[model samples]
Target: MSVEGNPGRRLLDEDRLFSSDPSQRSVARRLYAEIRDLPIVSPHGHTDPRWFADNEAFENPAKLFVTPDHYVFRMLYSQGIPLESLGVARRDGGPVESDPRKVWRLLAENYGLFRGTPSRLWLDHALSEVFGVQERLSAANADAVYDQVQACLDKPEYRPRALFDRFKIEVIATTESPLDPLESHARVRDSDWDGRVITAYRPDPVVDPEYEDFTANLEQLAEMTGETTSGWKGYLAALQQRRGFFAEMGATSTDHGHPSAATADLDPAACQSLLDRALSGAITAEDAELFRAQMLTEMARMSLEDGLVMQIHPGSFRSHNQKLMAGFGRDMGADIPTRTDYVRALRPLLSRFGNEPGLDVILFTLDETSYSRELAPLAGHYPILKLGPAWWFYDSPEGMLRYRRSVTETAGFYNTVGFNDDTRAFLSIPARHDVARRIDCAYLAELVCDHRLDEDEALEVAVDLTYNLVKKAYRL
Candidate 1:
């Protein structure tokens, strides 16, 4: 492996995301300069906690970038690239590509598929900033780039914990199910390492009746907590027990990836019947949705009691490709966004807890239409609600600009939490945050250029967006 690259070629521009106008670009640069070195606050995400716990070297370039990131594989998959070639495992333990270099070559050969996409930005950022690979990835340079990144991964400084500190992460939260033992989080907590990696309770498997192995998951929960699942009260108690244990492991929040922002405040007898139907395998699609909806309210109530920030990102039609799901299982980038109605859907929960100052419910949406129309208005009015950053499908430069334009007028700055990478690609964390900070700076600069906001005030708001709001809203 060598640093041999195209002569005089640099992958990223110094002022990549700033305005083209001289004065506005100057303002953006000043704001970015003020907050560019701030510690990353990743409040909710899907990165595995075991990376920090085990403190092991990453496997290879392909596994590091291509295989685990849906953002990468999904774009390639859209261009008729079989996921098998990219090392996405089959559910029946069937064979797929095993050679990491081969996989990396495939991505490199088709690297143009990612051009003008956020995936390209993140990949290039990671390669250049993290590994010092200055050349752009291509079929010609794939082997060189692969070897270059692999050599970095072979070093102790590139280990997960070391990279955590090097990335200047103040604290990052990994999402976990109630059935999870939090062993990795426990290991991180008990180790001498000072890196802060905490867990967030994600109870989709136990709460959503239509989840895969739903009954079996509940049975496992009962086994873990010694509470029966046959009754609603006992099941709630078991969930509380798991939440308590997660809190003890340093969780500050609970995350929900429901299909919609639906909520219900059903009575005890109704809840008992719903539980019976759900457990007995007679749950209807509507009933399953209701059960999930009611659980959102219930989780909000529990959040008030235990002080965990509640998070919901609704409106993804997850696992949309049945064939892909059957072979590869869930979250293989088959998820598509669906229109979500928050005002009507959240009424049940909002009516009960909308006024509570103790509750903090952070809302995210795959549907950008909600940012101005639904989310901003709701967050602006509700004391307990806070808008999350542009998320999931919209974590790109253009998408982020759209989000700021849409939300700031109604929700303003304080009604929202700041940026979280929300990624499984560990290396992309810093790149993603860099994109956010730059985008926020660009947006603030635009406001200052238009005389809508003062330059000094915009600089202060930039710091809050990069650091302060995330800490306050997620209680991190």
Candidate 2:
């Protein structure tokens, strides 16, 4: 399963993220050496499970690296590179680039657009480490690199299952709505190949009153789960039924991607009134937000009962680009992080379950200002809460460093789960995890150098941060 390195042509430096200081760099390298090869426990992600179920060869580099990945296209898009030219399919079946080589060339030609971004690090890692392209990608070598990756895609060892094993992923969870059939996950579970692919229940389609096809999604949920949606209780029962089904399909967690961390604990009558308005398509924006907030608390209650870890990643203003959304639909790299408030927003849910010994709630923030001020103090004191990794816009080297410095003094290492890539770019999974591990090693080295922590303690914390905590927190 080994691909020979390109030797001098590697895009990644051997000590890419280690400290620049000689003494601290040595310590970071020593700490990273032990846990760098640990099996990736991807307890949360957005990889397509069908890749493992069907075990098909990835079609091409453009499809794998560019089209589906918002991180890649968003930058290209920001530079005025039309998504259509990058082979992003239009919603109305409009003509886009049919040539994969053309799309890949756009990435290579505009490679400098990603120069200071994590996208650059990940793409280069995939190019040299995975495909052995040897040299930096450029317009000059675009087609040649495209051909090389296409050749690899056609090979047996580069198929999804083979690459999953090659990546050393112990288990990976793909997010799915409660209304999803999970046939892909079912196929992987029923298959003989034991690459542990699982699902996480993302109830946004059903819980978020503002979700597209809101009423229709409820109908589908009711029909699929054989529970009524005529009343608030029936809707809850239907969602609960779907959660049970997802658990049967090997789900260990439930994920909520709400717009904010707001939560509400309301009476049954109030819940029913909001449900009626939502179902009738007459819910006000305020009511819609309240409904979403209440649902988080309900989901937390369900998690306590079902033993599914709860993941709340709030503060994304989804589909920010109106024109792009109309033509290309959601997740076209248009989801922007908005200013978020967690302290008061999460009070309702935390007031109820914050001290529950059985409840495991991982809180994520798009708002970094809350790291030390709100999120760390919350996780530091609350038994139910744990800080998720530095996420979304801030998952880079500097971002990870900012997160550790902000939260560690208050929440400490145990109050935070290890890193989850949270990506649609499947090839970058290992690269993202590798970046987190390296940043952690570098951070731990600083602590050792300052004498705040002993070298031995830093090493143990590195392993915990790199691997163990994710498994424990996510129950993977």
Candidate 3:
């Protein structure tokens, strides 16, 4: 019952059914065995670059495991645990937990809240494989598990760079704002370290009018790029310049986190007028959205010219909890998934670049219903469009399975980019990637067993889907 007493054992019993049939289960096990130790290709994620740049030993288990993870905190929040108690830092400089072990106990007490959730799978995997915890994280074994993890984390082997090497991560991408100077990225490059952790250009603050301090962010972008961000043409040029700067820093892609899957194809004059209204702060919510939509099209056009991959992650109702958002700020696990429409919303952008062979736009959605209805069909036909793997809310085992089942018929394995562990928790990278590979193997096993695909074909597709597809998709 204690992690210290019986180390190096699995939390769950082997009898647990991840797959239904014994034959398919065997195939899945074999398939997982092949890529189980393969190098991780984390093409897109939200992990802090400073962790790798600094290469400092993590302070404690709770801060490393519980606090920063939205999946962990959101579940705790759903069970009536205040975010402030879980050591979630406030944006307005309010007080929060300073004792990491106390936060760990609170999370351990409420661990059952995530029993059937993906968080449980990730946690168990991290505990067993990463920290070598044998016992399950119940209230009884919480302290023991915490102590063991804390002890291990205090070691130099558990440092970010060491773990990156131990995890066999080939490349990891951290998202960065346009205003960021990428000093950490520069440090990573200049250091003797061989780990390939790159930055992704996220232009939300400069592009999205609703983003906090949008005006100031625009001024900063202008200052960095020496382009007049006040005008429409100069704004676009500034963005292009910043994107080039990111490209030089090893960025192969640009990410847009828009509110919806909206896109527009406004002419130059209309775009300038919209920008003027937005700058004057006279733009309505609807106008702001339209401008964002138009920017998607503009970004795609730029991608076509520059050869950088484009990623659109739309349909998040970000900061749903107004109080939590106001107190703790963004990404405190208050963001909820809403139904996203891709068909009509992306028509403008697709119409302009859908047939273009030079452009590559990978689409990720929070709405599962759109997988077969919108995403698959779009990716199936458009030369420029490719479906990103199950993302964010849907980046679970069942979610990945659902994605394969739903989209495989139309988009196929080649049309879809392989898995990307888009996580902020650095330690969970291996666990998340493991879950994805397992689910994909299970899906392929099912296909092989059903006689839909031969064993040889399944093996090839599994390897490609797990490794090659992602590398090619992200231009790695």
TM-score of each: 0.99, 0.98, 0.97
What are the lDDT figures for the candidates, one per model? 0.93, 0.92, 0.89
**Cα shift from native, residue 324, model 1 (Å):** 0.9
Tens digits of per-residue lDDT, candidate 2, 1-476, equal: 12233555556788998888998999999999999999999999999888899999999889999999999999989989898999998999999998988898888898888888998889888887798866788888888788888999999999999999999999999999988899998888888998999999999989988989999999998889777896999999999988999999999999999999999999999999999999999999999999999999999999999999999999999999999999999999999888899999999999998889999999999899989999999999999999999999999999999999999999999999999999888899999999999999999999999889999999999999988899999887
- Summarize candidate 3's per-residue lDDT along 298-323 as a digit string, tens digits: 99999999989999999999999999
The TM-score between candidate 1 and the true structure equals 0.99
**Root-mean-square deviation of each candidate, in angstroms?**
1.2, 2.1, 1.4
Best by TM-score: 1
Question: What is candidate 1's lDDT per residue for 307-343, written digit by digit as tens?
Answer: 9999998999999999999999999999999999999
How many pairs collide in each candidate, listed in order?
A: 0, 0, 0
Question: Candidate 1: lDDT of 329?
Answer: 92
